[model samples]
Target: MRIGELARLTAVSERSLRYYEEQGLLASTRTPGGHREYPPASVDRVIRIQELFAAGLNSATIAELLPCMRDVDGGPGENATPWLEQELVAQRDKLDRAIGDLERSRQVLDEVIKAATGR
Candidate 1:
């Protein structure tokens, strides 16, 4: 698919897709006319990339961590266990902090609404 179609499929902007390419998070093949052509699996990859970014993993870390997401049997490589476990733990901690922040923000909004409505 083309970049536009990939963006739509991935629910990401075209600019983001291009930026992902620039960040080395995504790869595409150029057509004879210089247009980028992405495989269908790029959609899933884009979604995964967005999730990783949302979890507070930077691009470089994501690039390293993506390869670690294989089956338990390690079809990709056996050496990814230690690094993958550490990275995943770090990502989880970051996500927990974000969730706590969001909960606090929600509570504040709830207080504001209750005050405004005299509840």
Candidate 2:
């Protein structure tokens, strides 16, 4: 499939997809006309890439961890090693801290909204 098709299917922008390619988190081939050609596997790969990014993992970390990721099932696949498992633990800790921070922020916002609305 073409980049655009993959982007639409994945709900990721074409520009981000290109960026992923540049970061080596994704792989693609070029058509004879010089346009990008992605295989069907790229769909899940892109989703996995996005998930890792959402966990606050940088592109380099994501690149290193990609092979350890499983699609659809959203678990660590057989490609996982001791090193990658350690990285996952660290990333998960980061994400947990971020979630707590956001929850606190949301509670503050709720209070502000209630005070302003006199509710």
Candidate 3:
């Protein structure tokens, strides 16, 4: 499949595919006419990549953790704790903090509204 086709199928932007290639997260071959050709496996790879990115893992960490992502039992390596798991935990914590901040801001806004309305 071509890069555009993969992008369409995976719902990821073409620019992201190119960036992934540049970052070595993805590999592709060039046709004689200079078009990029992707193997079918790339579709699955892209899904996994996007899922990890959504979990708040950076590209560098994803690169290092890609091997573990493949292993069903979290691989045998020491670093195979599944960075995605740790990332998800961190993201949850960050989200909790954000929610608290938002709630505080909302309370302030409510007070301002009540004061302005003399309620």
Highest lDDT scorer: 2
Which tens-of-lDDT digit does each residue in 1-119 have in candidate 2? 99999999999999999999999999999999999999998898898899888878899998888887666566557686788878899989888999999999999999999999987
- Clash number for each model: 0, 0, 0
Against the true structure, what is each candidate's TM-score?
Answer: 0.69, 0.74, 0.68
lDDT of each: 0.84, 0.89, 0.83
How much does candidate 1 score in TM-score? 0.69
Instruction: Note each model's CA RMSD in angstroms.
Output: 4.4, 3.8, 3.8
For candidate 1, list the clashing residue pairs, or say none: none
User: Clash pairs of candidate 2?
Assistant: none
Give the lDDT of residue 32 in candidate 2: 96
lDDT of 2: 0.89
TM-score top scorer: 2
